[model samples]
Target: MALTREPPAATVDPSNPNIVRWEDIGLTLIHNFITEEEEAAMIEAFHAQDPQKEGKRRISQHFGYHFDYTTFGASETHLTPVPSYITNFLPRLPIQTYLPDQFTVQYYPPGTGIPPHVDTHSMFDEALYSLSFGSAVPMQFRMSGPNDARKMRLPKRSVQRKSDENTEPASSPATAEQTQANAQAQDAEEQSACWEILLPPRSLLLMTGPSRYGYTHAIRPRKTDVIDGKTVPRQGRYSITMRTVRRGDEIGCNCAYPGVCDARIREEMAARRDGAI
Candidate 1:
C-alpha cells in the first residue's frame, strides 16, 4: 500500500488558474486570494486591535474563543465575535458549507518563526485555512517520525496485567524482526517527503485530510529564504489562521490518522485498561 494518498480531484477547480494543488499532501495554495488594498486594510485592522505599541518579535490575538497554549484546548465559551473586516472575505473562501468561527492573527518579524506543530485534532475540524499578508515566507511540512507511523498502523490490544501474573512475550522473534523492518522502511519514506512551500503576500493556503492530520508545519527562523537558487530577504509578516471549532458529545476524534489524534489515543488507552481516562 502507498504511504501517501492523493487528495480528491474536485478539491481544486480545473479552470481556476490561481489554484496550485499539492495533491499528495492535500494542500492547495490560492495565489492572490486577497487584493493588495484589502491586505493593507487587514493589517491596519490588526494594528488597531494590538495592545502593545512597542515592537515585538511575535504578537498574536485570538477571536471567537481564547486558545490555551499550555493545555492545547479552546475555551468552551465564545469570546468576542470575529471582526467584520475579517468576515468580509469569508464569501471568497473555498469552503462555503460553513464559515469559520475561530481565528488567530499573528505577527512575525524578520528572523522569527513558529515551531513545527500539528493542530490538536479534537479541538478543531479537518479543514484549516490561513491568509498571509505583509510578506512571503517558506513554510515547511514534514511527515511524522517512524515511531508515530508504526503506532498508527498497529492495533492497540494490550490490556492491563496484574503484577503477579506471568505472561509470555508480546511477539515472537520473527514478528519483532518484521516490525523493525517496517519501521526502517517508514523512516526512509518520510525522510524523502519533506516539502517547503512559499506562501506569498495576499495568498491563502488550505490544508485538509492528510496535510492537516498527518504532518507538522513550521517556518524556520531566518532572515532570508532561498528558492530556486535565488535568495529572498524576509520581511515582517502577518497571518490570519481560521478554523471551525468542533463541538458535540462525540467520544473522540475519529479521523483516519489515529496516532496523531489525542482524543483517539486517550480513548484507546482507556479501553485497554477497561476504565475511564
Candidate 2:
C-alpha cells in the first residue's frame, strides 16, 4: 500500500485511523518517547508512588501501581513538557490530554496482564493514549462481528487459539437454536473493537477508532515457568493509560475522580457553595 502521507500533519476524525505498524499504519510516532534514563526515573516514580500506599487514590483492576493526584489534570500537558524530542511528531493527531482523573499505572508483571475489555465510556469517541517503557509485550487484537456472548471463560486449550479464530469455546455442544444463542453469546463478547500491538519501552500505544468499537485488546504479559509448575507467573510490565470519558447524559462531571461522585453532585455542590456568599 502506498503511504497516504497524512500531511505529516495529524488530523482528527469521528473515524480515526488505528495504526498496527508504523511502516503500514500511516500514523507518525511522537518520537522515541523516553530515554533510558527517563524511563528509569519514571519506573522509579511508579514503584515509589504506589496508590496502595498513597491515600489519594485507590487500586484498580487495571493492574500495576497507579497514582491519581488531585491536580493531575490542571497541569499544562502540551508545549512539549518533556522537550520536542518527546513531543508529538504527528501534531494533527488528537492532542492527548491527562484530564483531571486519577492517574493509573498498570504494571503487568511478566505473565500478569489485563484481559480483553472495552473502555467504559457512554458518549463521544475517546482514545487510550499510553506510554510504555522497559521490555516489550505482545498486545492481541480481536474483532467483534455480528453475534454476541458477553461472558464466557476459556480453558487452557482455548487460550492457545490464534488471534483470528472465530469459534467460541462453550462448555458444552449446542443444537441449531442453541448454537445461535451461543453465537450471540460469542458475538456479544466480541462486540467491542480491539487491536493489540507490542509496545516496547520508550514507545507509545494509542487505541481508538475500531479499537474502541469493533474490538477489545489485551496485553499478553510475558510469562515464565513458575516454581509451582502448574501456573506460569507474569513478569514486570507497566503502562500508563491516559484517556477521556463520555457520560451518556445531558450533564456529566468531567472530574477524573470516577467513583466518588456524579456530575449532579458536583452541580449541587457548586450551587450550595455559591449561595453561601
Q: lDDT by residue for model 2 over 55-89, one digit each (tens)?
A: 32223322211222232221233221222222323
Best lDDT among the predictions, by candidate number: 1
Cα error, candidate 1, residue 34 (Å): 0.7
How does candidate 2 fare on TM-score? 0.47
User: For all the candidates, what are their Cα RMSDs to the real structure?
Assistant: 8.8, 13.7
**Poorly placed runs, candidate 1 (over 4 Å):** 1-13, 51-56, 147-191, 272-277
Give the clash count for each candidate: 0, 35
**Top candidate (TM-score):** 1
Residues 1-277 of candidate 1: C-alpha lDDT, one tens digit per residue: 1224322343456899789887877889999999998998988888888855347448888988876564465777747788887889999988776478888889998878865567778878778999999999988777766555444334433323322111123563336566577656655654565567789999999998889888877788888888677998888999998888777763257777776777877677778799654
